[model samples]
Target: METAQYDITWTTPMCIMTLRYIGLVMDVYDGQKPKDKVKPEMMKTAIPNPPGFLEIAAYGYFFAGTFVGPQFSLSRFRSFVNGEYLENGEVRQSSIMVSIRRFVAGVVYCVFNQWGAVWIPDSFFNSQEFFNLPFVWKIIWNTLWFRATMYRYAMAWCITVCLFLINILWLILACF
Candidate 1:
């Protein structure tokens, strides 16, 4: 548990770096100015701050969920990403259904995350003022942060799923 708290605590910086790298690559990929000329501000939207994790989390729906969906078993995320899935060049009803399901899954996760967030508050840390605190308070600040992190993770995961579905829905409509 201690390790998990530490691991999640740093996702903010990592996600930011990832967005920066991708935005740079994408600008070059799209025939825009070279990465050297790209301003950091322009690409920062892809990776958001910790408190703003929800915004960036939604991208998972597109880049990861749409490209490589959850259930993590389905190869949709990988196959579509690799170009192999489009080899035959066909978009069917089945694909659209998968997209919807991803968003639905995200909705479920969002519900759980919201509920958990309400049940726990930063007040739990107020106990730190007492002269002799329980051993549980050893890392109360860390605990509060951990709960917040879990809530954020859930939001990110769900939003990403929903985003993927939205993208797929758009593609399916475009095909027709």
Candidate 2:
């Protein structure tokens, strides 16, 4: 059981690191792309040293957005680590109100989905009554299915937003 848990813990981050490594290789290896074929954005401004293995490991296991991520490119990650993410010396303040609003919205969606789910019989779709139902009723049931499942997506968005909000708060507090 411990082995299984250990495997699960390492495997996910390993996959994430693998993908990030692939992106770095595709960008940095000149042999992978002919000079003429490279896009303007792909051209390195100034040749920077490739990140070391330890740095890559740190970035991969940074714990924020590792599971459900809006993944950043290698270049963006590098910029962030080097403290060059904002060039203009402007810090964007994250609104706690906005975060709270999203959290509230997510909670409402979850509650509504749970409440509505009680009316939806688990075996209803396979039951004869479902087949015997009129076309209008079928359409309504389909709509209900759509509504009931929407909380999952909403919660996912809420979680990501909350993560960003926390990061922003940390940044603000740290700088002061």
For each candidate, what TM-score against the reference? 0.43, 0.64
Candidate 1 collision pairs: 61-160, 61-164, 67-77, 68-77
Q: Which 10 consecutive positions of candidate 2 have the poorest summed lDDT?
A: 1-10
Pairs that collide, model 2: none
Candidate 2 residue-wise lDDT, 70-159, digit = tens: 566666776776668665866666557777887787787777767765777446777899999999998999789767767655765675
Residue 63, model 2, lDDT: 57
Model 1, 1-176: lDDT tens digits are: 34522344445545654654455345334334454655775443322212134533444434643332332211232345555766477555445566567667667666665565565544545555532666676567457656654755666666666675666767667877
Runs in model 2 lying further than 4 Å from the true structure? 1-32, 39-49, 62-64, 76-89
Per-residue error for 53 in candidate 2, Å, reads: 3.3
Residue-level error in angstroms, candidate 2, position 59: 4.5
